[model samples]
Target chain A: MRTILILIKKEFLQVFRNPLLMSILIVAPMVQFMIFPFCADYEIKVLDIAFIDHDGSRITQDIIHSFDASDIFVSHGIIQNKKDAEKMIQHDKIDILVEFPNQFEEDLMNGEATRIAITANAINTTKAGIGVGYTQEIIGGYMQKFQEDNMFIASEEQIPARLNLSYIYWYNEQMNYKNLIVPGILVILVTLIGCYVTALNLVREKEIGTIEQVNVTPIRRWQFLIGKMIPFWILGMVEFIMGLFIMKLVFGITVQGSIPMLLGITAIYLLVMLGLGFFISSVSENQLQAMFIVLFLFIIFVLLSGLFTPTEGMPQWAHYTNYLNPMSFYMEVIKKVVLKGSAFVSVQTETIVLSVMAVIVNTGAILSYQEKSK
Target chain B: MAALTIQKVNKVYNKTVHALQDITFEIQEGELFGLVGPDGAGKSTLFNILTTLLLPDSGDIQILGMDLINDYKQVRQEIGYLPGTFSLYPDLSVKENLDFFAVMYKSDIEANMDLIRPIWRQIEPFSKRKAGKLSGGMKQKLALCCALIHRPKILFLDEPTTGVDPVSRKEFWEILQTIRTQGITVLVSTPYMDEATLCDRIALIQNGKILGIDTPEAIIEHFKGTLYTFKSANIFSLLEALKRCPLQCNYYPYGEHCHIAFYEDMETAMPQFLQFLEDNQQEHGDIEPIRPSIEDCFIEIVKMNRHE
Candidate 1:
């Protein structure tokens, strides 16, 4: 333990001595926390539509009025022909074109079904798809109202086969993108700092041949590694707390569960992270190789972590693979604590899994790292 | 008791290159030992093995009466090592580096101030200067101070004076001699043949094998032939002509002279040597018989061993 304190002292001096690296270590995460939420947003706005009314009728005017009334869309006015509507769509002034058939009102009066052909640009797939969905919903409601006004379907509301489809969103009531994404991005930043800094610390020593000097001493492998890990562990916590503060200040995200519990989980997860760094440094030949290995692993971890996408939507094999990713488990744990205010017992399984990982990976690193390769 | 004992040690790299081959040596408790050879002569490989940083492939080593594998932890606590390269944290100031090493050894800098005062005094003025900013000589001193801060029982220095200036190299050797007076065994390696004389005993090693081991004077006296220092104004051509001559002698380049070994005594070979020099028009410098140094003995032994 005394040796470990000395090692930690040495590690801290080395870390704080390089002012440039220290600045980068502290400032990079702060900038990421401030800007990344805005980049990962998923909301869309502003819809424009054009109409080519084949039949000059009152029902068609009412069909256009439904969309124009909502703030989501604006009408570019009725066109003389389909060609004019297509021209407006080509000029990028419209997102969709609505064409009513020639006998649109006549067919309704004769009790025959009529069709309105809505053609979406489909160039921007998501925008076009959602725009078409909204337009269809409006038309369906308008047709129902039109029939009711005429007393043609007065008993349709009495049908027992309809679904109320009540939806209530918890955690983020306003569907604020920042609230959901900031916590997730904070997990990634913390993981990167923890893993990248530790790997570089050891590998830099190897590059400068300082490890040999340490190897010549009486220091045990576990003692040396423990000492090496402590500084970064403390630094990671420092960065995490700073990130938490910025997260609350910029996006107003506060942990709902016990802050102490969250801190405890973070401390253990950092051990697994530092172990990963040591493992990578043990095998890599140089700094570039270690950097690339961490990068490759980070990419794989982030994609499978359910950070930006839903893990439930993935294949069964991919869904099961998330269990192996520590980052995935931590991401879930952080969200549960901060966003949902989950009780400690509720997150017991993930925390326990992380603890086991911390033990296994750290022991694995200590065994694999040898003072001599041969 | 001997400070270190290496027995039939062999190291093979890449499954082909013999890094160390059947090496054996022993150093007394207070002796200053030097492993003398040129680059790629397995000097660093041997130093690494002795320091417990490397394990030999096929032999056993004992350090301070403890088996290397069984008692490495205890052995490491007792030895101080300076590796083949500069390895202290470059961004750290001299004082910080020293303090950190002292703490690592579970000792205090104040405890060993008397031992490192000569080195530390030279560097004390620049104590706050970053290690990277110090000159090469100062860096050597700082490395030496760090290695000695722990008051180790055995010191292993690998090529400590390989790139140091002549004056600093001499001073560094003086420090080692002073360290020896304190009854600490010192094991040092160097490629500069001149440094061999400063050591009490040296092992002339080449190609992972020890050719000879003895005091500098004894090794020089063991050379079996009369050595002649041959020099001319055009030294390169002189070396070329001597090697081409039908004199049946060994001619190898010493610093500025071509050192040729003749099995016959100098009285019997001088007339023949002068005849050849006349035929080759190599009369710019006088030919004279000179006593052999450690370098002459090394070249001769390497040639003899390689041929066999």
Candidate 2:
């Protein structure tokens, strides 16, 4: 343990001595904190849409204008036909097309129910899915408003029936996409910087030929690896702090629960990052290879870990895969703690799952390091 | 106990290329032993095995009376190794590199002041400099200081002076000698033949085989021939003339002279060689007998062993 402390001091000395690396460690994360949360949003702020209003009635125009006034949906006047609407969608000039049949209001007056078609470009599934949902919400809201203004409920003989849904987005009441993305991306930035720096640190030593000198020393492998891990772990924690401050200041994400509880889980999650980084460092022949391997793993971890989407809603196989992803647990822990104001007991499962992942990955890493050191 | 012992060590790479074959040698305590050989001659391999950095395909090694494999952890605590390349952290200051190794061995730099001062004093002024920024000689000095910071029982230095300047190389050997007086066993390897004289005993190795193991002077004394240095302005024609001349001698071109080895003393063969040179019109060339150098001895042994 004493030797580890000494080695840690040596590692820090080197870390401070390198200006470019130090700046990147501190500065790049600050940049990510500044830029990533705003851009990694899932919310579709604008939906360009064109409409074919065959009814030529006041109700159809009113509904179309209501869809346009939702602040998220915009109207591109009209498309004469389905071919023109498809062309507009393919040209990226519009996103959705709402077509109503002719005599739509007359049929409604005659007590015959009618339907309208909404065609959307489904190339980007998230955008298309959200756009369709927004369309349904606006039309539903318009129907309710029309009923209230006209002061008439649809009886059994009425042409149009009314259904109502009030979407109460729990946790994020205002549906601020930044709130959803910032916390999850905060976990990712910390994990990313932590893994890459730690992996490259040891591999750089190998490239510069200092690892052979280090290998011949009396220092134990665990002590050496742990010593190497501490500095980056501290750096990762610092990056997390910056990300948290940025989260609160820029995104207005108030920390609802124990900050220390979130950081405590972050600390455990960093163990997996550090361990995996050390494992990669030991296996890689140089820093370049180590960087690429860490990057590949980071992308895979973030993508499959439900940072962008809920693991609960994913396919069963993908949901099972999230159990193996440390980031998934961390994302849950952060979101539950910060957004839901959940007590520590509420996130107990995620914490335990994260702890288990930390143990497995770190042990695997240390043992792999021991094997390579031989 | 002897400082180190290796018995019939064999190392083969890729199951085909023989790196070290049937190598056996030992060094006494406090002995400054040298393994003299060229590159790819298995000096580094033997050192790696002894220092516990690499395991041999087949061998038994004992360092300081402990088994290298079974007692590796304990043995590593008593050994210091400076590999062929300078392995100091380039981003670390010279003092940090020194302090790291000292602390690694559970001591401080001040604890081994006497042992490392001879090497450290030269690098003390640049102690704050990054190790990579220092010149080649300074880098070697810093490496030596780091290796000695722990004050191990045996120090393994593999080709420590190969790329260093002559003056610094000489100073390095002087420091090694100084450290040896304090009762530390030293095992150094180098390709330069001149450095062989500094070792108390040396194993001349080539192609993973030990050509000869002896003190430099004894190896030179055992050269069973009278070696002659033949120099002339026109070395090519002179070599051709001497090659055609019928004299019972073996010859090869040395730096500025053609070295010829006679089985008999020069006095016994001089008259016949003089008549042959007279017949070949090469009588004007300077012919003088000289003592056998380590280079001359190494080549002679290599030739003898290859033929046998």
TM-score for candidate 2, please give it: 0.89
Candidate 2 Cα RMSD after full superposition onto the native fold (Å) = 3.6
Across residues B51-165, which tens digit of lDDT does each residue of candidate 2 receive? 7878888888888889988888888788889899988888888887887888887877887898888778899999889888999989988888888887899999999998888
Provide the TM-score for each candidate, comma-separated.
0.92, 0.89
lDDT by residue (B1-308, candidate 1, tens digit) is: 89889899999999999989999989999999999998999999988888887878889888888998778888887888988899998988999889878877878899889989988999999999999999998998999899999888899999999888999889889999999998889999999898999999999998899999999999998998888785667878887887777766788777777778988766767888888888998865666778988888898899888879
Local error of candidate 1 at B300, Å?
1.0
Off by over 4 Å in 1: A47-97, A103-111, A121-125, A141-166, B265-268, B281-283
Give candidate 2 misplaced runs (Cα > 4 Å). Answer: A53-68, A79-85, A100-117, A132-156, A159-161, A371-374, B224-253, B256-290
> What root-mean-square deviation over C-alphas does model 1 reach?
3.0
Candidate 1 positional error at A70, Å: 4.5
Question: What is the Å distance of residue B120 in model 1 from its true position?
Answer: 1.5
Q: Which lDDT tens digits does candidate 1 get at residues A1-374? A: 76788788878888888887787788888778778888888765778988888887888988988888878888887888777788888888899889998888888777677889999988888789989988988887787677767765335553334333555779987878787789888888778877888888799899999998988877778889989998899998888888888888878888898889998999988989999999999988789999999999999899999888878889999878888999989988998999999999988999999999999999989998988657
Share of real contacts kept by model 2? 0.73
